[model samples]
Target: MADPNWLDERELTAWKQFLSTGAAINRLVDQQLKRDAGLSHQQYEVLARLAEAPEGRLRMTDLAGAAVTSKSGLTYQVGQLEKAGLVRRCGCAGDERGIVAALTEAGWQKLREAAPEHAALVRDLFVDGMSRKDFAAFAAGLAALHDRLNPPAI
Candidate 1:
């Protein structure tokens, strides 16, 4: 009988592939962003999320959540962006204690410059490398995993 505690050969291979592939992709993305825009992957994510938000702004807490980073981490990244003149911090209108991060024109330009190369890299490394059927299945699997990890709040 097979041991329930151990992954079978196929399962082990899949698990190892997932970890190594994800790490490789992350490293490549970080390197590409840093080389092309002088931005780290986390900073790029923050800028992209802000750009997608209404009025190109979001409360710090909301930004942290959207960026999948801790509040402190988001704050530090925002501070760095502020220093670069790419983002600004302002008090939220309705909530005195709420701090909002707004993307500056510079931020928009940076994101614009970074996006094309980023998208092309993603397509080259991930999308074009897989068949449509396989890609769809992989996407579905990832979506399911995401949903499982982040269930809706009551």
Candidate 2:
């Protein structure tokens, strides 16, 4: 076999730091959202995606994609949101069997109420902690890595 490629010292350090920081950040956000909005980060993400879609609605698949969640996970989250009166499911406009998730008025209100604190948390933990130039470079690098790791289909 050809020589195996592996992470060098710097790459290994970056990888570990990236994973730990991401995990810590996710936990912090989830804790805040749970305490304030009774929502998980993923649930908030689902609602946020639906909120931005045309007419505050999106097909189930589209919402899942936008939220970067699996279909089953999205289904469960949507069900939870539905029970809370934050969202409603309906038959898709073009396909009877296809489901759509639509944000309710309550959902809009919840998002609005939760947004300011959520944004502040993100800025405090991530954005504002870095110099503007550093933040920009970090974001650009992560975007490139993310795109490479999850390339678009033809």
For each of the candidates, give the backbone clash count: 0, 0
> Compared with the true structure, what per-residue lDDT tens digits does model 2 show for residues 91-147?
997797899999999999999999999999999998998899999999999899999
For candidate 1, write residues 30-137 as lDDT tens digits: 999999999999999999999999999999999998999999999999999999999999999989999999999999999999999999998988888899999999
lDDT of each: 0.95, 0.95
Q: Give the clashing residue pairs of candidate 2, or none.
A: none
| Candidate 1 lDDT (Cα, 0 to 1) | 0.95
Q: By summed lDDT, which 10 consecutive residues of candidate 2 come out lowest?
A: 91-100
Q: Provide the RMSD of all predictions against the true structure, rounded to 1 decimal.
A: 2.3, 1.2
**lDDT of residue 125 for candidate 2:** 93
The per-residue C-alpha lDDT of model 1 at residue 150 equals 91
TM-score of each: 0.93, 0.95
Summed over model 1, clashes come to 0
